[model samples]
Every structure is written in structure tokens, then in C-alpha cells.
Target: MLFLKNPQEAHLQCLTFKKEGKSIGFVPTMGALHEGHLSLVRRAKEENDVVVCSIFVNPTQFNDPTDLAKYPRTLEADRRLLESVGCDLLFAPQEQEMYPAPPVLRFSFGHLEQVMEGAHRPGHFNGVALVVSKLFHIVQPNKAYFGQKDYQQYLIIRQLVADLSFPVEVVPCPIVREADGLAMSSRNRRLTPAQRREAVILHQTLQEAKQRLLNGVSVEEVKKWVASVFAPLQKKDIRLEYFEVADGYTLSAVKDIHRHKEVVLCIAAYVGEVRLIDNVLLFS
Candidate 1:
């Protein structure tokens, strides 16, 4: 596997691959290499001739400085994992290489930015847009893979590709989870042993909510039940930040749950100092 830290060099190498008629598959990640990340690489390897995995912890995306500062960086282990997954290239750029100057431009995603993650993390999607746009340009891959764990993020990148008319396909993979159903996340590393056990409630609550909605419960009542489930966990330091049942496409809150054919139940909470997010899609 070729390990590249320079963006210019990575760009040139990808260009050479293009000239040679190779189809490149790209997976952009903030490193802390877990099975969930490797799952994306495995899918990419199956679909493309060459797979390029990037492990840059983008600073622009974090609204909270402490969160960025505490973000994990495990490059050596990440490289080993990439090599195991048959990744062809690794573009791990320094902040200076990625951003010689602060990004002055901003991205607007209409109402897509007004709820859930965007509502909580101001300018988060703008940073996501800028960095993803940069990576898409640098790799110029025929296909890019992202996990559906961040469903909103997947949708935003889809919009980014369509709006910008990039000649690349955005593929969304399934959310990988632990054996006990906790969604796999890099932040899972920060959870204390007890917090890790308690974290399962996030997924369980979503599952219960899904079943409740299926049983003719009101959207408001399902949302309230989600809060009630988390209420007991507050003593355990698992606090619910927000929960919503919304249209999957527009992401607008669904007042009448029966109106939408498909909606996603999304949640975010503080499990100790580590904030985690998870969701389940409900379809009628």
C-alpha cells in the first residue's frame, strides 16, 4: 500500500491511476480505525480497482474546541487496518497541507441544516462540506463510500455531488454495530466501562420507539417515550440531548406520523463526556 501525506503528491498519484484507466474508490475518515471503518474499506475494495482511505481529523468541522482536541488519532494502527483491508492508497494530510488558509466560503443546505446535528453544532455542515469537497477534488475517485450511521451527512454529501455536478458516485453503507446493538463509533473508545454498558440504551430506546410507532402510537407519544427511557439513565450520566421523528428526505419534524411513508428517528446524548448519536429508519 502507498502511504501519502502530501495532498499534491496524492492528487498526482490519483491522476496517474485515472490515466491508466483504474477506477478509484475513496473512503474519507477521521482515524481511530474500528470495524465500522474497515467495513467501508471492504465494500470499496469489492467495487473499485483502487481504494484510497483518508485519515485526517478535520479541525473545521468541530464547533467545540475540546471535542476536536479530544478526537482520537491512531495512525499506526489505522495504517495496519487499511493494509489488512487491501486499501491501495492512504492520504493522511496535515492540517497545514489541507488548509493553508482558513476557509472563507460557507455552504447552505436549506432546511437540511436546521435540525438535529446542524441545529446543535453551528457551522458543522459547512466544515463538512468544505473538507469533503476538498477531498473529492483531491482523490477524484470514481466512487466514494460513507456509512449511513450519519444519515444526514450521507444525504448532505449526496446533495453536494449533485449540486456541484461532480463525476463521482456517493455510496452509503449500513451502520455497523456491536454484538449487543450499540452503534460502532470512534467515540465509543472514550466511554467508561459502565458508560459503555449504559450506552446500549440509545439503540434499545430507538428499537422500542420503532415498535411503538408500528403499533399505532402517535409521533409525539413515541418521542416522549424516548425521553422517558433516558430519564432513568440520567443518574448514570447518560443524558438525552435531542430526539426527533422526521421525514427522511426533508428532515422536517413529522407532526402527523402517518403522513410520511418513511421517517428516521434520530438521537444524540451525552454518555458522560462523550456525546454519541444513533438513529433508526421507520417506514410505512
Candidate 2:
């Protein structure tokens, strides 16, 4: 696998693929690679002639300075993971290379930006949009892969592509989970031994909530039950951030689960200091 750290060098390498009529599949990520990340790269290998994976933990996306400071970076390990999955190119650029100056433009998706992850993490999507747009430009791939763990962010990037006409297909892969059902995240590594055991609750809560919603429980009542499940975890410093059953496309909280053609259960919580999010889609 060819590893290029400079944006111009990556662009030039990818340009050669374009001129040769090769299809490029891109996976943009904030390093600390895991099975979930490699899963995306493996799928990309099947569908496109070349796969480009980027590792840049974007700074602007973090509302909490502590979270940004604590984020993990393991380049050597990430490289081996990518190579094993047959990734063609790795665009691991420095912040200075990607952003010489702070970004001034802000992207707003109106209702999409105002709820769920956006409501909790202010200015998060804007930073996501910035880095994604930058990578989309640098790689110039025919298709881009993103995991469904961040379903809202996937929707936002689809919107970004539509609004900006980025000329790349935004494809969402499934949420890869651990053996215990906890959604796989880079943050999962930060969980202490005890916190790791406690982290399973987020997935358990999501599972119970999904079944209840489908079994004729009212939205309000289902939310109450979910809260009650997490209520006991507060003592352990594991706090539930927000849980909502919403329209998959519009992302507005659904009053009646059956009313929407596509419904999704999304949740976020903190197991100690690590913030984790997960979602399960329900079709009506």
C-alpha cells in the first residue's frame, strides 16, 4: 500500500487512477483502526478498483477539548490493518496540510443539524463536513464508505454531497458491533476495565427499546422505560445523553412509530468519560 502524507501527493496519485479509468472507493476516518474500519475497506476492495482510506482526527469536530486531547492515534497499527485489507492508498495528512488556517464556513442542515448528535455536540457536523469535504476533494473517489454507527452523520454527508455536488457516491456500511452487541467505536479503547463491562448497557438499552417500540408501546412510554434502564447507571458515572426514535430520512422525532415508513432508534451515552452512540433501524 502506498502511504502519502501530503495532500498534493495523494491528489496526484489518485488523479492517475482517474485518468486510467479506474474507480476509486474512499474511506475517510480518524485513525485508531479497528475491525469495523477494516470492514469498510474490505467492502471497498470488492466494489472499486482502488481504495483510499484517510486517517486525520479532525480537531474542529470536538466540542470538548478534553475529548480531542484524549482521542487515540496509532499510525503503525492502522497501516498494517489497511494493508491486510488490501487498501490501495493511504492518505494520512497532518492538520497543517489539510487546514493551513481555521475554517470559516459553517454548514447547517437546519432540522438535521439541530437534533440528536448535533443537539448534543454543537458545531460537530460542521467540522465533520469540513474534513469530509476536504478528503473528498483530495481523494476524488467515485464512491465513499461510512459506517452506520453515525447514521445522522451519514445523512448529513449525503446532504453535503447533494448541496455541494461533490461528484462521489456516499455509501453507508452496517454498524459493526462487538461480541456483546456494543457498537464498535474508536472510543471503546478508552473504556477502563470496569467501564468496558458497563458499556454493554448502551446496546442493551437500544435492544430493549427497539423491541418495545415494535410491540405496540407508545413512543413516550418506550422512552420512559429506556430512561429507567439507564437511571441506575448514573451512580456508576455512566450517563445517558439522549435516546430518540425518529424518521430515518427527515430525522425528526416520530410521534407514532408506525407513522413513518422508516424509523430508527438512536442513543448516546457516557461510560465514564467515553461517549458512545448506537442506532437500530426499524422499517414500518
Residue-level error in angstroms, candidate 2, position 104: 0.8
Instruction: Write one digit per residue (lDDT tens) for candidate 2, span 50-160.
Output: 999999999999999999999999999999999988999998998898889978998889999999999999999999999999888889999999999999999999999
Flag regions of model 1 displaced more than 4 Å: none
Candidate 1, residue 103: how far the Cα is off, in Å: 1.0
lDDT of 1 by residue, 95-199 (tens): 999999988998999888888999999999999999999999999999999998898898889998999999999998989999999999999999989889988
Q: For all candidates, what are the clash counts?
A: 0, 0
Point out the worst 10-residue segment of candidate 1 by lDDT: 253-262
